[model samples]
Target: MKIVNKLKYIGLAMLTLFVSACEEGFDDINTDPNSPVEVPASTLLTNGIFNVGYTYWDRDLNFEFGELMVQHMAQNEYTEEQRYSFATSDFNFRWGNLYSGQNVAAPTGGLYDLSVARALVEENENLSDAQRANQLAVIDIYMSFGFQTITDLWGDVPYSQAFQPGEYPFPAYDAQADIYTGMISTVTNAVNSIDTSVDGFTSGDILFSGDMAAWEAFGNALLIRMGMRVGNSAAVAAGFGGTLPTSDIMLTFDANQDVANPFYQDKVISSRDDFRISAELVAAMNAQSDPRLAMYAMPAPGSTEIVGMPYGLGDGAAFTLKNSTSDIHTNIEDDPTAPAYLFSMAELEFFRAEAIVSGYITGNDATAFAAAIDHSVAQWGASSPGYGASIAYGSSNAEKLNAIALQKWIALYTNGVEAFAEWRRLDHPALTPSANMAPGVTGIPVRMLYPNTEDGTNGDNLAAVGTVDLGTPVGWDN
Candidate 1:
């Protein structure tokens, strides 16, 4: 899965010289081929941040796998994902575009570029201790978030020796248990490392232009998220209470399609209208009279009704049903700049409700549940009749827990990966497995398959590693 293309090794000077050799002002004698040019930390930071959730992540994680399995949407073409039969090659883009990367490479991963940015900050002679701390902390949070998410999705992965190509060309896959433990430490360090005294100077801080409060909250939000992922006994109490209010960390898009939300950019602006709303999601929303349904999807063409496509239909079958199924709404579609909620106050409220459900904290279940619903509505910026009156908070804590999980799933429409992770851990809404699954694919997949690159480049390491099936849960799922 380590496919960097070695393109980053090709320096800009070499390309320029090769192209301009016939130019009159070309001076091969004065140019030093050995001189190394480093890209600025600021540029790398923005690029890394954008790469994390945009392009590949949106397609592979959000649409291809997460949304399909979660029943948010079904693929209209190929439809292999809807059938729950995916190939190893289907996941190769994750490694090449997100998990594995090299310096200056096209499609550089979030952690790879961010870690490179961190290195630059650490090595800069002019930076003060506080300045370095401020910059490094941001990278640390992103690195930890990327590692945590990758491991959550794929189980055991190359973590400790992943970025260090010189030391371990074919890094051994780390165990999910060990990876989770390490991520807790890494995220904890990042959350505590923010130094507000020094300015986070930059020209390329796209997510949050040097806002220390936002950055620190982002780190804490990540910390709480990771802490909960592994079911830490003390995490609920320590990570919640008042902390939930201010710990939202997210990527906001402008109202312009020029730089709108990544998914918005791909589907609406790019005109890749390949996905339609899933019947499961639409039916559930309609049953509860959820007001967000209108904001989430549009009516079918030439029809005033809003319906979703049946889950896991073949391409031909879906084509026939296309007239009935709804597409994404203009609220999200026309407004290309709609914010892609990575982490938000609404999610924090759900965590609070979950903590109470797990007995990790003491709070009124109904109160917390209501708060979560309100937060979710506010997060969408859509007016609603509200969930309190219709969607009842059940009497028992067990029933409440199911409600909380299912409600969270509904609220997490755009954040498909996180929704999948929560489904694996919480097991609510009871998603049904697709009929007539593909060979080797079991019920709805709990984990992603390793890429085909491992079979060739690291066959020995791949062999030594344990088996990975879609049905098998990761280390933290229990």
Candidate 2:
């Protein structure tokens, strides 16, 4: 997969124009009828896709928040988030970007851009019915992915009325159950709506290059993912009934400063080593002799051993352990053009295995389970001979599901948000709460708290949603 360099140019140009148009004298300067003030759907698509990919790789949200919470990575310096102590302000970026957007003069958010694109697609006069339908479906599919991330993070969130500023300024937060149902329906409909005969977006499509077939596969995979997440095996079966794409849905980055992989820039370019592999994860992999460990981390400096830092340690202790602990592998942190995955074929296989065990799909659970591991190892280009034979798929459904969940956790490396969500849903390979926890923090957080700004801006709606706390589980988690 290659990063579209044109996306960077288009995004920057649109932002400049957007900011200039907000000035008082700008509108008067542009009197030409042919000059369009409104940003086109293609430009919006580029902005939205880039933001979504960027957010997933963001240090604050995905690393410090999701990865730390799930014990995949640990803090080596300030340990507030690692110890489950964080201000509501920590979530403002993610929450705001998903619902609204940043930059008052030139806002660009995933949901916001996709919504604008949908409207523009509907209004386009040159597009044929099939082209328009496929385009709209593609937008909806991306929107569904964004919504799923939002609802999974918090128990309830603004969904039904979101993005309709004039209609519902303070959109009521929809319950997680209702949101999941809606998302599943949206993905299903989007998959059905796609017309393979025509292209979705001939330009500005960063994921699949306007391939409707890829879009359809992505939608089905998303549907299955959501269904399996909420314990709806029937939806999983429905999704598995269709053809799955051979490739993962991802966004690739380039070495350019404007579009470099965030993790790479943070660790290598900036020379910041604020995080280390967690001892918990290291111990888990060591127990199974997981071959991916070599691919996931580097040996501690001056030693051949790959040591992990103790999770949730105090600032002094964490700093002390930092040098002895391994950082992320050079292949990852040292490479600026790595790909960030939205959904992977490995994850799809895991879902299929789960659906099979649930008796909702016709397939051998063990075969799918083995294939899942093989896909994961192949995807990472790791050597793991006799790996599948080493692990056992137990007889009972509980044991089988446990095996799947544990392996899925390992396979979901670097994708902290999705990994955290699955850990909450499965509760397998039970993780211990940090012994050096923050004040008033007794257990691991099940969900993220709403951003503090929401209270000031949408206080009434915020209050109506009930208590917002780290301890409260999301709908599917319970």
Candidate 3:
């Protein structure tokens, strides 16, 4: 698979500019030399990409909420989240960072930075028409990705009215259905606007270094993913019509502490052992004699046995069995340079197979299903000749869809955010709530609750969303 190295030059360039600017303003007494009048688009682009990657891959939101809910990873210390004990405050990080946080133009994280970068690029007269369009299109694709993540978790969220603080201070929450539709429009427009002949971002393009063709492919793939998400036949067709990205869109990292892989930093650098491979995932893999299990989890300490920890248990029981259970494989958990994917070819192939099963597109489900597993296994640095044969594509469409969903679930091991949404849609593997769950947690939660911050700041809009709870289904789940 082709991957962009995410060169560290962006940081160097920013530092060089800062150092150069300091000398110019040093003689002036009135000027505040510390702050720049305007930030460059390249700087904003780099920061926006990093923020998106960091926030999505965050341990609290990704591992604790999404992974545990989908039964991929089990909590070892804080079992409350694993047991469906959720607090509205827990979601504040994702909500605040993704929308309007402290700064309107340059928030600490989320789509605000991307939007700002797009505006800067547009305003820059130095750039040619092709360069400006390509850059803006790439930014649009990224913003759509971020917004989709937001709407997927929460049913109704601030979208259309968001990012305009001066005009609409308290942005109204947009319906999940409308958000999906808006994303489709954004992604479609972005894809159409891409001019592959020209460069998008000549610098600070961490994902694909000025590769407009790659950006176009990424946009198209994103559209397909979104289409499958909302069960929109027209969207599926439109996306399939264009070129689908063959390689994975990844978030790469370096040795820099600020940009290093969060999972590695938390698990190895901090020496925290708060998570383990879940028994549910382990049993499923074990049943199929999955070769990737060796790569997914490490053997129990001292013994070459992969023992998965129980999903959600009391603190005492969990601690007692921690040593006996398997930690995640070092290649994944401890590797500082491991890339987090925005989208993978494996997932795309799975979507293709699913689209066929659902009559969204015309293709052979069996062939696409086999390709999906092959891509997944190969991507994880594993090989199993004839592995596709082990998982049968049944005669009926329903059976084929179930098989695709189950394999796709395994393929999406660490990508808990995407996995959570897929699980809600497919409902395969038949997951149940943990036995030691919080009171009133009768079943698995289909959607995340809004942050308490929303009630405090946007009280009117919050109340207008109507009564909701963890079990309430998002629009796509129907």
Q: Which candidate leads in TM-score?
A: 2
Residue pairs with clashing backbones, model 2: none
Q: How many steric overlaps are in each model, in order?
A: 0, 0, 0
C-alpha-based local distance difference test score of model 2? 0.76
Task: Give the Cα RMSD of candidate 2.
Answer: 5.9
Collision pairs in model 1: none
**Model 3: clashing residue pairs?**
none
Task: Give model 1's TM-score versus the native structure.
Answer: 0.87
What lDDT does each candidate get?
0.67, 0.76, 0.76
Between candidates 1 and 2, name the one with more favorable lDDT: 2
The full ranking of all candidates by TM-score, starting with the best, is 2, 3, 1
Tens digits of lDDT, candidate 1, 1-478: 1122234423321221001000111111122235433777777677667656553336677777787878888666677788887778877666555554322323343555665566677779998888777787777666666666687888877766555444455767778777767766665565466776567756667777887656777766765677677877454455563233353456656545544665666677677766788889989888888878877888888888788888877778877777667887767656655656678777887887777777777887677788778777766767765554467778887888898888988888867788888888888989888775787776888888777866677767777777777787888875
lDDT per residue for candidate 2 within 1-478, as digits (tens), equals: 3333333333323221110010111111122233332767887787677766676666756787788888989889988888888778888766765554452212245456656666677779999999988887887778778777778887787776665545465667778888887777777777887889887889888788998999888888987999988988767877888757797777888777556787887877778888888988999889888888999899999998789988878899999888889998888788888888899888988888888888878888888888888888878889877576577789999999999999998888888889999998889769888888878777999888888888887888889998757888888887
User: In terms of TM-score, how similar is model 3 to the real structure?
Assistant: 0.90
Model 2, C-alpha of 327: deviation from truth (Å): 0.8
RMSD of each: 8.1, 5.9, 7.3
Q: How far is candidate 3 from the true structure (C-alpha RMSD, Å)?
A: 7.3
lDDT of 3 by residue, 94-151 (tens): 5765553221212143455565566577778999998888888888787777778888
